[model samples]
Target: MATLEDDEADIDPVKMILLDEEGEEKKLTTLDNGAAKPQMQKHYIRSIESTVAIRQLPSEGLSFQLWPAATTLVTLLDGYLSHLSESPLATTLTALSNGGDNGRKLKILELGSGTGLVGIAAAVTLGANVTVTDMPHVIPNLKFNVEANADVVARRGGTVDVAPLRWGEDDDMEVIGREFDLVLASDVVYHDHLYEPLIQTLRFLLNAGARGGEKKVFIMAHLRRWKKDSAFFKKARKLFDVEILHTDPPKEGSRIGVVVYAFVGKN
Candidate 1:
């Protein structure tokens, strides 16, 4: 895992180019962590659809810092998933919202859950059983943040768990047995070196649906930082059916662009 410094403004990303089948070339956008302070700090995220306040403890490593892609996903979940609207994700949301007394909770696994913002929002607002995972070094603060909001999540009939997952490790994969309806990741493609391991993890989780299990869906919210970042998407398109659900410019006039994608097994 790479460590990011307190200030990333001067860190120019590795330049790369991407071309489509038609030979059309497009510039890749640079990623910005966005106002992330590398210090022990607490953050408050308010739900747009409800009065739930998600508490976050961002401490220690770069993985603990809050990122904009997490915020975008949280906002999307808070604003859109709250209602029982007619969308591709509606069935999953319905299962989550109705899980409490029905004894059938919609299980969710969040990979690279920095600060656990999006997962916490899902637990507290949607009452889904969410397992938030990240690197081992970042698990302490991640667990602390989860415990700090345990009561809020429990009160809403949801539960939060934390695990240490280092992408392509066999032990980590053994620990994270495949049994989730939805898999989530936000802004995890910043480092080009991690593309293979990250995609491997996704493949493992997505393949859990084989063997007569329920269909699984993967949703990722990404902030494109450079043209090379598209490499991950290109690699992923070969493994799963990918769809762009939403797109928006980075907040506060950042040069990067944000897009949310939903993926399902091709079979």
Candidate 2:
């Protein structure tokens, strides 16, 4: 088992390039409409063993900001790609399912994609086609980040698509119906109200794979915030075979521990 230290990465420091100066005229222009100025934060993701450069922002809401779990998952995924054939689950997650030799690309779907780091990592590192989704308000930022790294992903023989998906919505589920070989999520199970809805979404995605006779997998990295929020994991266990792939407290930043889990439908 590889420790988090083995896969640790960093976020680069923000540059001092300024877009505009804050002056009395700027304040007056904004105060005329009584609307608050937009605040956008820039971020750079630094990987230990990957060449991809990822930048993201909080375009709409708290849901659109980059989270620590995203960095952890991408680092872990980058590490896992080095030893793919060692684990059956990893092989299934990344291998081609055309009934021939393995070591081919995969189709991935990322739930609650937020700033699109993990999805981009899947595309750039694993050479997988990834669809990154989130709520409608967050789609703009998600698309921005995905497009920001378009060349890097393409250079690695992968592609990225951004979409809006609200969990437990039939229409949203239809937009992503049965198409992905793997599903990825990070830091999504925080709210207790989302427990059943998240489970329903997972069930829908896993059953899609079953209908196609392909063994699909859902991989998630969650940093537990409250004991009661474990309901999502508890609910997931009833529908899928849930296995913890990795667990480690954040080596830097806040002390939230990330636990990666692989889930497959029950037989």
Per-residue lDDT of model 1, residues 142-213, tens digit only: 887888777778887889999989998888998998987788888888888999999888888888773246
Estimate the overall C-alpha local distance difference test score of candidate 1.
0.69
lDDT of predicted model 2: 0.68
Model 2: per-residue lDDT, tens digit, 1-267? 943323334222221111112211112123345543444433232432445444333234447556667767776666666663344445555454453236556778999987787898888777778999988988877777777778788888999998888899999898788777788999797667888888889889988653248667888887665556555666777889988777765544434466778898987
Task: Give the Cα lDDT of each candidate.
Answer: 0.69, 0.68
Candidate 2 Cα errors over 4 Å, as ranges: 1-59, 83-104, 210-212, 250-256
Task: Report the number of the highest-lDDT candidate.
Answer: 1
Worst 10 residues of 2 by lDDT: 15-24
Q: Residue 31 deviation, candidate 1, in Å? A: 26
TM-score per prediction, in order, is 0.75, 0.74
Q: For model 1, which pairs clash? A: 28-227, 29-225, 29-226, 30-225, 31-225
User: What lDDT score is found at residue 205 in candidate 1?
Assistant: 88
